[model samples]
Target: MAQGKLERTGFWPGDARLVISISMQFEAGAQPERGASGPFPPLDPKYPDLPMQTWYDYGVKEGIPRMLDLWDRVGVKVTSHMVGQAVDRHPQLAREIVERGHEAAGHGQTWEPQFSMTPAQERAGYLASIASIERATGTRPIGFNAFWLRGTPNTLGILQELGFVYHIDDISRDEPFTVPVNGKPFMVVPYTLRNNDIVRYDSPALTVDAYLADLKAEFDLLYQEAGRRRRMMSISTHDRISGTPARVRALETFIRYAQSHPGVRFMRKDEIARFALTAPGVPRS
Candidate 1:
């Protein structure tokens, strides 16, 4: 596929120096009990990992609420990638996300891989996820993020046929770009693993200060690069990972640090995709 690029002179809305897109994952109850990541290996499939299951449950009971409060305090909106089964189990929380003025994007029916599925099964999975988010939030999601950021050859075409405007599985660029999916335009707002909470806090377990420093460093470089052309910084957080008090504090500090700059704006991924599609000098092939 031919990837689109913006002209060197292009700028974001209002000519902002840097646009920060924040993604908050909401996939607590949707994952299978046997494959969860924790300090120890998961138990055999024959036995239920009750402790591990509750670890994810914390995301629903405490993590999400904490993150929501932090965003409210900072006056920044984010995109919450809601899994279908999780939304169905907690429709009120799903509705509350939209009510609070954040975008609800599909993250699949369950936190399972889709790359190995047949094309028909993948299509059905996408459809079911979209329907679940729509039913719970009263707003259909136009953006999708596959579980584990994996996609098959048929992923883009299926998404376009299902009327999705964009997907976040691509990590090839720092800014939004479009590619042809069955001869129609589909947007790819790239996601990042470098700035992901799961990678930093959950696995390697970086210190709060270290995590904050990394975020600021990333923003600093991108802010400088944006002076020449459009640049976007993607920061990812999970309900079960970055929602803890210490990690959330680090995230809030990083946000404030970025805000102190002259021309850094936090935007939702959908907003970024739409702006890129219409922005001058952005290729739309």
Candidate 2:
């Protein structure tokens, strides 16, 4: 199979050597009680997992605010992938995310999977999420990310119909690309798991220092490569994960390190999508 690549002639705006996109996931209180448990045995749906619930609660009560402060102090903007129900539960925090110069993109109505839903159910979920985010933030989210990065075959078509301009579920490329959905161009800003905080759980032996080292290594290579072709480095953080003090400190360090280099810019996913729409050679197979 042939692979599609963004044109090397010119890529990001201002001829930047590299663009770094930060994703702050806000889905703590919106998660299903049984999904993604932490250090707890399986419990019946009839019973609530109190500890797990409160663990997620920490993200709301502490994580989001700490992360917001970090972004404010560092003078960088990020995209917050917010769950609709989560935003509804804390509209004030959602508003603050937008007020602090961050983009609020849709994650879903809740933290449950949408892939199993029928097309009608999926469409309804998308509609509900769009309404919730718009109601809270006063700006309709034009980008969508599915729960657990899982989406059904009908996901793109439904998102396009609902007026979303882009999605980040795709991880096939480092740069944003366009895919034809419903016979029109829809953008895909590829996400990353390599630089994601979830890896800490995926590999319990990993330390925060190791994680920071990985981020720097990834950035170093991409920054070097971007001299010839456009490159974008995506760092994924969650309110329950990277929003903690130690992890967020590592994140702050990485951001400042990136800033030290010339011609590197931090961009929101929407900004990347809009640029991909106009850039040449951004079509994917």
Q: List TM-score per model, in order.
A: 0.94, 0.94
Instruction: List candidate 2 stretches off by more than 4 Å.
Output: 1-9, 34-36, 44-46
Query: What is the overall TM-score of model 2 with all chains considered together?
Result: 0.94
lDDT values, one for every candidate: 0.87, 0.87
Superposition TM-score, candidate 1 onto the true structure: 0.94
Clashing pairs in 1: none
List, in order, the clash count of every candidate structure.
0, 0
Candidate 2: residue pairs that collide: none
Task: Give the per-residue Cα lDDT of candidate 1 at 260.
Answer: 92
Across 58-163, the per-residue lDDT of candidate 2 in tens digits comes to 8889998999999988888999999999999999999999999999999999766888989998998888998999899999999989977899999999999888
Q: Name the regions of candidate 1 deviating beyond 4 angstroms.
A: 1-10, 283-285
Error of 1 at 216 (Å): 0.6
Location of the lowest summed lDDT over 10 successive residues in candidate 2: 1-10
